[model samples]
Target: MKITVKELRLILTVDNLDELIHFYRDTVGLETSKEWHEETGNGIILDAGRASLELIDSKHAARIDQIEVGERVSGPVRLALRVTERIPEATETLIEWGATSVAPPTTAPWSDVARVQAPDGMQITLFATSTLEDK
Candidate 1:
């Protein structure tokens, strides 16, 4: 038997729903498709444009951190997003929106990447396909 999955959503169970929503929707510029609230919990779905599901062991995840962000992220999971341009500006914007600047925009093997930590301690990598010099 086979099962078909329709769509994938990255659900972040956050301590402060409003702040997380603002960070992703306003700072990161993802469109908010829907939101819900209950007495016990709340959730928001932001449009990530395109998504890929990756499964890896802890060692591989650490290696990806070393390769992309130049350091090993503390957690078992990391979130990455691809942006068109202005990665430096985007990183700064997120910082202004209350995220911590983990690393400045730098050229990685794949693209120009910037690492930032959300208010809830989620490490996010923002990247663009073109080099920073070109952008």
Candidate 2:
């Protein structure tokens, strides 16, 4: 048997839903496609552009952590966001929006990456595919 998947939505049960929504939607610039507020619950769906699943082993994850953060900092589930702005600018913007900077912008073999811890304690890695010099 095979299963077909159309869209992937990562639902986060957060304590401060409003703040997280603001961070991802306003600070990160994801367009809000849908939102609901009711007795049952309140939620918003933000369009994150194209999404892809990347599976990596523990060793590889640790290597990536080391390269981006200079240490093993990320847990099993880390959110990697591909941003349009340069890494430094993006990182600074996130920090100003209440994210804690885990590491400075570092140049990796594949891209320029920076790590920040969200208010909900989620480690978010912001990366740009274009070279740092280009941005």
Candidate 3:
């Protein structure tokens, strides 16, 4: 299987998009590229790596019957991410910034990746890549 673009940004609609944006900006160091407000709610487009993260404030409206709340997500929260080498440092920074961990980082079998949670309850997974020159 060959693909040019292997991934796309995951979008999560939350109750408080502003709060989530603040956490990602201050705690996780991702920059916001754009923001928009519609009749339904607001949306923030974050410039985490290459793709822009879309956080739409639609949780208040997603509670009809079609949306099934996940184990980690309440309302319409998502498992967003930022690629980092020092998972420990990333986790520590999240803790220092009032982000509560749903569970501590643990290595996933068959892969060199770690999973953690951010405050406002975002599932974060850190994976290792060998494309770094130096940090």
lDDT tens per residue, model 3, 86-132: 65676667777767654455453322344455655665655444333
Stronger candidate by lDDT (1 vs 3): 1
lDDT of 3: 0.56
> Candidate 2: where is the Cα deviation over 4 Å?
130-135
TM-score of 3: 0.56
> Per-residue CA lDDT of candidate 2, range 6-119, in tens?
888878899899999989898989999899999999999998877777899999999999999998989989999988899999999999998999999999888989999998
- Which structure among the candidates has the greatest lDDT? 2
The total of clashing pairs for model 3 equals 0
lDDT string for model 1 (31-72, tens) is 988878889677888988777776889888777678766777
User: How does each model score on TM-score?
Assistant: 0.83, 0.91, 0.56
Which pairs clash in model 1? none
Instruction: Score residue 68 of candidate 2 by CA lDDT.
Output: 93
